[model samples]
Target chain A: MTSEKKIRVLAAKPGLDGHDRGVKVICRALRDAGMEVIYTGLRQTPQQIVKTAVEEDVDVIALSILSGAHNELLPKVAGLLKEQQAEQISLLAGGIIPDSDIPYLKKKGIKEVFGPGTSMNTVIDYIKNYCAR
Target chain B: MDCLCRKISEEKERWVKTTLNKAKCDRRTDENGEDIKVLYTPDDICAIDYLSAIGFPGEYPYTRGVHASMYRGQPWTIRQYSGFATPEETNQRYKYLLKQGQTGLSVAFDLPTQIGYDSDDPMSEGEVGKVGVSVDSLEDMEIIFRDIPLDRMSTSMTINAPAAVLLAMYIAIAKKQGIPSTKLRGTIQNDILKEYTVRGTYIFPPRPSIRLITDIFAFCKDHVPQWNTINVAGYHMREAGCTAVQEIAFSFSNAIAYIEAGIKAGLAVDSFAPRISWIFNTGSRIFEEVAKYRAARRVWAELLKNRFGAKDQRSWMLRYHTQTSGVSLAAQQPENNIVRVAYQALAAVLSGPQSLAACSYDEALALPTEKSVRMSLRTQQIIAHETGVTDTVDPLAGSYYVEYLTNEMAVKINKEIAKIDEMGGAVDAIEKGYIQKEIEERAYIIQKEIDEKKRIVVGVNEYLVDEKVDQALFRVDKKVARQQAAKLKKLKKNRDGQKVQLALEAIRRAAEGNDNMMPLLIEAVNAYATLGEICNTMKCVFGEYRASGWSGR
Candidate 1:
């Protein structure tokens, strides 16, 4: 079960969306997949999300937003990470995000945007591959 | 064990063997994955006493239903949960819904309002009017209900945390509409317990939150007798992935805490219990969903009667609203959700809900569009008019399978409630993350089942297709944020700042003292104080609640 290191991931719900089923599911899946996952509970600002990701020294930041606030919140988190010199941590998110917004979110520095019907295994595998190098 | 029971079991054995020996990989299970016998006979419900358990409708322990005539007298209210973007757009949507034969109105406030922030706050950037309608001040509330008369419409606002402020705004608007507070009819979804457990739109601590709920109860009982002060909701939690049994058990547990808070606040049970409403999510699992409603009503009736010693018949009737599950909607084909929502709405009707809200097909992808919302409302109409489901009272009552499932669900849910009772109460269980962990575990199991192709999600796991879905989705313009911000600024500039300050200070003093804050909140809204200002003033007194996870990182 041992590897070079376990993938430390920070999962958080930013802004005022209270629907955390997706985020909690991802947090548990990543934790069960042998990643050190820290779930920052709901109503988090972008600053708090990135602060925990950096402080916990996580490799990935999984931002879950069902409130459709990702476009506004995602870039804020990414910008904060860049300003705080924590830009190396990959930003990925999944929720009720539309396919039309995926490209824009990706261009905004999100590594991936998982929408509805996404598999947890796919998410875990993506993180594993992204961190393997 | 008994000879008669053994004979009935032998008969069922013969029936299963002769009629139903087919494929066997979990084949005998319901949609919820619960094992079901091919036949349920008298022996299945041997322990039940019909006189006490399944009494007549409108009777004590109302497992059959809260009303005697049920849908025969009048069909369940076809209330659509509609709201998105600016208040003006939402008002238009409401008018359209009412014109399309919607009987009741349900308002869905956006994230900023739900969590008690004005649309202009820096914390509200990019989020205003995204999830629900952005309601910033009394002016927004006025516009939301503008040509719509307050006296006739029984509105339901799904806004918690800052429920007092919103309720205040509603009361003030009714006043402006020349309607007395006593004549105003509606509901404020002030159930904050589920927010701490599942939905995360909570502000202030649980203690103060409960206090505000009690304050609403006390105020509404004498002032706005028609208003439902708090709706004990399991709708969000079930959408968050709790099992049917947990939905009933946990929401009732939260109900117990609220009832206790009301009594502690010196309000009588009969005074508020009649107006108390329960909201359940109608899932795709037909039998389980029906049984969940039956079981939920039974549990609530018994909880009110036995635990709280409520004497009035109205206190024992568990009136509830049902909403089709949003989590059950598929994002793939998207059209499949119409069928799913129809079936769920059918279950809600069969379960005898006081009201039902059908989720539009495109809800999973975005806010429901005009066509989709109309389609959903027509879906309810079809059930009411074309389908004969509303012709009788609890049509599925006599079915052996339904009765057996209902009893089993009641027992399982009772066990969970007992466990929560042992662990102090719902509030304590939530603070301990007990319910959250249970829901998360169930959510994980369902997600894993979908991923493994065990549980079939038609358009997702099965019926695979690569065809692009070009269905129109309702999208909120980014300018909605700017517009709401600008409106809030103009309102602040136009209003008497000194009066707003005095009203907010009154709210703060009431929050600091043990006074019920509803009167002060109503005064604040009358003074044109924004939701954020009122909530921030209370926050200055009670402080905001910050939840750190069990990981302790």
Candidate 2:
């Protein structure tokens, strides 16, 4: 597993939502899965998240939002990544996002959207498999 | 007495070996990780002297209940925390709730408003009216409370960092309605310590944030005598996954800091202690929760009387509001949340809360629809009237198990409070990242337990389902942001700029010194100064708080 570089993932909360329980749990799970995880603390803007992901050269940016602002904030992060020519970094999200909003979020460049009750093992495997591909 | 104790112990031992072993009974524990014996008898609570330790209701060390009559004289207030979209939309919801027989109001402000931002600010983009109602200025406040007389209504605003500004707006609105400040009654979730640790809506650092709270305490003592100054909250921390024990201990530690800050600021303990109230989360563990509340009341009563040497009896009471735990709800089968909330609400009612807010069944996914919220309120009503649980004061007081559990919980809660006190106080512990780390660890453990299927959350880990969610969810209007931003722009342009500027300047001056901030805040709020403008003025003096060290790494 050390032969290849450790999978670097950037976990960010990109709005005024302070619901960090899901994000914190996932961060720990990813780290235990032998992946490097960087958690940008609460109340981060989309631009800041994109900048950190790009500067850190992380392979993925996992966004967690529960305040119902995913429709506006998630797309903006995806857009900012494209604007910065950092579209290589895969984008995924998990929170209270509805199933109906998944298609639109995917179209906006979020590859996957995990809602409430998704296990941490599922999230870690998704990242490992996504990075492998 | 000795012979009876020995006989009970022998009988319990015989039962454990014969009946318990035959049934293959496993060792059990409560949420606080305390071991529980299968059978409890007179020997378990024989050490407790009934007159002193388990006193009568409304007496000193209020372990049984706070009121002597309990729910017989007056039932608990049914207040549901709700709001979303524009002020007009939220006003309709409030009026609807009142018409539906809700006893009190609990306001849920939007994120931007909670964190002291105008709707038009860049930081507020996409978040204007999402989680709660958007209030940018006095105009928005008036519109929200329009035609609802403030003097008669008991409102609770869930605002922390910007609690001073919001309370001032409520006061100004009351004054406009020809009601005196003394006649107003309500509570502001003016707790900032929990904001730094659990709920992240803090604007300033701890020192100045607590200073603002003490200022409110002092001001309300003279002007708004009926107002509860601060609702020191453990509900959020509990929602973040702390045990019921940590919830009581941590909130009391935070409360001690506030009371000390008030006394340091030259206010007598009795003057502000009577106005101090609390909010705790009542979860699915019915027996443990009931015992937790009972233990909490006793600890708080003793803390006020023995530790602080308070002379007033009202100051010794631990009057609290209970909200059924939202974290316990499962999003898999949203309908299952109704039964969960009903059980939690039953636990809270049995524990004797001053008020209660039952989480709606559909809350795990999105904001609750009208139908879902009404069902939640009706859950409380059924417990009050039909269930007959509230028929007697402290109905479960004499049960051997509850009495024993209450005694055990009080010892553990006091031990935890002592640990926090050893770290100087809650403020110091929070600054050192001690409290945050503790809660994060517990949260991770709880999550892992559920993931491993050890914790059986119905419809989540144990009961699997493949049906899609089909409930009619309430959706916040996306256009509410644009409308609020435009309204804020117009209000800024139309108000007297000179008066607003003068009021903000006075706040700046008061914030820099030891002056009470409520009057200046009320003046600024009355002059149409935005919440952000007032908070920003103080921010220039107090600066903003940036959390460090604790990254959940």
Candidate 3:
């Protein structure tokens, strides 16, 4: 375990979905788990999220979309990250993601998909495992 | 081999005898983070004064319910929150719901409309009709309830930042229908404090926003006496990751701020306090949720009577509407959400909610379709009709566990309220990001528990399903934005531009002065001033609120 280095995360709500329960929950959970989380308030575009991720130099970017606009929004964010030369940072998606969309998202460079009911531990564990590797 | 045998024998002995006496028992904690005993006795509630804590229903300090025979005399209104795409579509849905036994109408505006943007505004691109119905101008509002009688039916609008404009449109519609504004009975979710802390749909900053809230209170007190001016909401706050105690505390603090604002505006406590309502979320925590509602009533009663010096019994009574928590639904094994919603609805019924809205099972995945929405309505109907749970007033009132939980919740919430009061008030707490940070921390702990398997959420971390279920979900039309934009452009071209401009100028003048804004807003809507134009005019006076500290630490 890194003794003093803070676990940094970028928590963003993508797409036009304004419902923020899941995103807020994840943000709280990550913070409680001793991670320094940066939450881009609502209605953040993919470009904005990517820019913030790069500037903040976050170790993880957790994107949440509930309006079923993930298929359109996530790819843009992933592409922006690559274009900005920030592809080394891990990308995670959450909030009502469908099983069918998981493999496709993984292919687009998203590391994992967290659907509804994903516990805070699962997220922390995922981050720890990925970061450790 | 001898050592291994001895270790095995010792372990067996420890498991069989020693561990049985020292095994940890499961202790339930309420949403407020208070520990609940495994068994509660009458001793737990010995301190509660029967006369003060729970007087007769419909009397002073209405702890049982606001009404004597709550569901027995009249059933709680099955108010469903529904809206979509265009004005015409939402109108049809309203008519359909009314036909399907929904007593009252609750309107949900899209994000753009909620934040005071027109359908054609650049900021509103790709979001015209994604979440809820888009109402750009008075024309759209007129189309929304074309045939529905404003006087006969109560309409509750879930709006915040642009609530003043929307309320004006409704009053204008009432005038066009030959119904005086005083005859209208409905509610506007003009609770903007929650918007800043949790919902994030705010327009102006805190000071000007409270001014707008006071403006509505003053207007409704004189003209629309029957209308509920503000619904101090804990629903969105709970959905945004606050615990149950925080929900009650923050919501009551907000209500107190509104009461103080009205008093500051030179209104009597009794004049507007009766019309101020509340909205809360009924979550998956069954007993805890019921206790929350009960505690909420007691707290509101004490605050209004003792703190605000409200003498009117009606002013002291707490009337609330509850919506099942949409966050509790699961996308995996979606059918389980039906059970979850049923329990939540049952809790709301037992908690003596004046009205209730049960979220659809498929809400976690997408906007509910017709069938899913029907199922949600049926869930509430079953509790009201089939289950016989609503036969008595506060059925779970005397249960030892419930009473204990209620008292515990009351104490915890009072403490939280005191904390916020020390930080100046709700507005100050919001500006300093105190409440937001607390909610964030609690939400994270809950999530972490789930992740660690310390909390079991069925069909998610456990009872894994390999197959997917086929369900029909609501899908917005792809061309909705383009079509809405075209309609808005046509509306601007066809309407009387001179009248719209004058109406906007009048609004700006009223906003600049210390004048009540409702009448000016009504005039603007009457002159066909689009929502965006009126909002832009206000924005010029009261600058837009930019959320500070977006980067979480």
TM-scores of the models, in the order given:
0.96, 0.98, 0.91
Model 3 C-alpha lDDT per residue in residues B1-553, reported as the tens digit of each score? 3555556656756664766557777777655455766556565666677788777787766778889988999998899999989889999999988898899999988888998888777667656776789999888889999999998998999999889999999999989999999999999999999888888788898888999999998889899999999988999888878888889999998888888988999999999999988899998778888888888888888889899999988898889999998877888889999999999898889899888999998887778888888888888888988998887788888887888788878888899999989998888898888988887777777766777777788888789888676777677786777778888889889989999899899989988999999999998999888899999999999998876536657
lDDT of 2 at B492: 85
The digit string of per-residue lDDT tens for model 2 on A59-103 reads 999999999999999999999999999998999999998888899
- Tell me the docking grade of candidate 3: acceptable
Q: For residues B335-427, what per-residue lDDT tens digits would candidate 2 score against the true structure?
A: 899999999999999999999999999888899999999999999999987999989999999899999999988999999999999999999
lDDT of 3 by residue, A57-107 (tens): 999999987766676678888999999988888999998766666898888
Enumerate the chain B TM-scores of all models: 0.96, 0.98, 0.94
Model 3 alpha-carbon drift over 4 Å, by segment: A1-9, A15-21, A24-37, A56-60, A68-72, A78-91, A98-112, A120-133, B1-26, B550-553
Question: In TM-score terms, which candidate is top?
Answer: 2
Extract clashing residue pairs from model 1: A18-B200
Candidate 1 chain B superposition, TM-score: 0.96
Ranking by DockQ: 1, 2, 3
Residue pairs whose backbone atoms clash in candidate 2: none
What ranking of all candidate models by lDDT puts the best one first? 2, 1, 3
- The 10-residue segment with the lowest total lDDT in model 3 chain B: B1-10
Clash counts per candidate, in order, are 1, 0, 6
